[model samples]
Target: MPTEGVTGANKGIGYEIVKALCQRYNGHVYLTARNAIKGNAAACKLRKLGLYPIFHQLDIGDEESIKKFRDYITKHEGGIDLLFNNAGVSFNECTQAYAKEAENVINVNYFGTLHAVEILGPILRYGARIINTSSFFGHLSNIPSSSLRNRLAARSLTVDGLCHLMNEYLSDVRNGVHVTKGWGDSPYTVSKVGVAALTIVLQRMFDNDPEKRQISVNSVHPGYTQTDLTGNMGTYTAEEGARSALFAGLDAEGLRGQFVWDNLAIIDWYAATPPKSF
Candidate 1:
């Protein structure tokens, strides 16, 4: 049987994604969260609804926690058929200094997600599907630096090069010159841009692996969903936001290495301009 799993699924779009997977995916669905209490609670809620979802504690920010989960999945399920890198954080209205916020945001949203993929990716079954939950805010247009944009859009970009760029951003933030160095003001936006770039990089790596070429990897913008991440200010509900991700996870074929929008349409992240209102 196929096995699917979602990270950071204790609440919001992550929770809704797990719920939908339990309903539609013909396999065991693992609902993971950093908090065991909340994870189990969410699993119980699903059980009450006549759906079976196994709960696992996963804190993407910690490599040890990720390894434990990876070992468990490897041992119990043998391998994962579908995986979602959904755990992330943002400080939209924070009063903290930009430098501090940047560190925290990038740590969880970019590095944390990257760590999860690095460990679990090896255990992904052939023809598996992987979805990286990115955002429209991550569009390349958000970064005003022409040179940086060119570097990021380059097809030759490597995973190591991408990591170097993210670390450089953090360094600039530490030196209090990120803005002058052409980095964006929103750390959340920049970190997500890293996520989007990582998606393409991962796809390239998969393409090089003869056995893994069938695994489709794509990044997606889950729309402006009303969830804790948005402080409930977004237009779409969490359930509504999960549709695009669900579509990509279950049915997207020949759609590899693309950035999909909430409408389920693929957009050129490098050339496409954000809506005027965005």
Candidate 2:
């Protein structure tokens, strides 16, 4: 049977994604979290509901942790058919130096995600589906610099360039010059922008890959939802918020490198427009 894995699935939308997959997917679903105690607790809760989710520990911010998970998957499952890079960190306020906060957030949301895909991409089965859980503010327009936006969307841009671009943002943040550099102050939004961009670029690589894995990569904006990420202040619940990602990860057909809304609609991230209400 095909196997699937999710990151940061102890709670929130990630947990809901695992729950939905366990209920519907005709495959083994692994629910992973960075914290072993919380991860196991979440798995127990699901077990009470008669949903069995194999709990694994994953911390996207840590490269060693990711490599361990990758090796575990390779040994236990041979490979995987689905991967949801849903693990991320976001905060409404920063108590410490903004740069420090930016580092942590970007490490998990952007660089960490990039690394996860880099390590796990090889294991994705032929015709596998990969989905990144982006944010509503992940659009290119979130960055005020037209030049940076153009660079990000340039056909010549590669994963290396994406890494450099994000590193530049961090340097600017540390120097307290991110605003002048055209990157907004919100690390969460910027990192999510990286995720969205990663989705597009990854899909391109997959399409042109000599291996011809025929994998499809896409992104989903789950809308503002109530969860730990948002301090439980949102218009929707976690279960409802997960629907968009579920659609992208499991149900999307003939879609590759597209950004989708919570209402199951795809849009142009290049265009700066109001987000559609689900």
Candidate 3:
């Protein structure tokens, strides 16, 4: 049986994903949370329902936490067969300075996810499946500048180049010149754009890897689900939001470096406007 792992599984969509996997997947499920008590309690709830789930502490925002989880998994399971990068943070309203909020959101959402992928890349076995939880806002069209969108979607863009571009967005925002520079001020949107782009980069890396080849990486937009992140403004429940990711991660075929939507449909991240089907 292939082992499965999920980050930030204590509640919301992450929790629902773990629940679905525990019920359907014929393998051990690792449910990780930044808070140990919450993580354990979540796993215990599943166990009470006669479903088995293992708990691990993973704070994607913390480099040490990510590395520790990677080491533990490699030592015990040799590697993971499936991974869902479902952990992220978002800001609400206009409470803090744009720079401060952008820094916090970008750090946890883009750099943090990037670090987690980089650290765990070595331990991802061949035939592994990785689902990156992006958002509809991740689409290139969300960025106002056509040149910026093209640059991000360029096939020649390397991971280092992508990292540089992300920092550039931060720099522009910090200097109060993001609007002029064509990098929008929404850190959450930009971070998720990074994630959407990173999915493609990772897939290319896996395809090129001689030893750790045959892996699949894709991004999924969980919809405007009602979660703490969204301040419960969305109508879709957490379970509804988890559907597309679960399908994309566990059931979909030949979905390499693609973007998925809440309706279990493949999304064109480059579309200038949302599909009518949306």
Clashes of each: 0, 0, 0
lDDT of 3 by residue, 57-146 (tens): 999999999999999998888888899999999965566677888888888888988898889988888788899999988888888888
Over the stretch 137-255, how does candidate 2's per-residue lDDT look in tens digits?
Answer: 89888888899899888877788898899999999889899999888778888999899998888888888887844898889888889998999999889999999889988887888
In model 1, how large is the Cα lDDT of residue 142?
A: 86
Models sorted by lDDT, best on top: 1, 3, 2
Where in model 1 is the C-alpha error above 4 Å?
275-278
Candidate 1, 119-146: lDDT as tens digits:
9988999888889999988788888788
Error of 2 at 67 (Å): 1.5
* Local distance difference test values of all predictions, in order: 0.89, 0.89, 0.89
RMSD of 1: 1.4
Alpha-carbon shift of residue 149 in model 1 (angstroms): 0.7
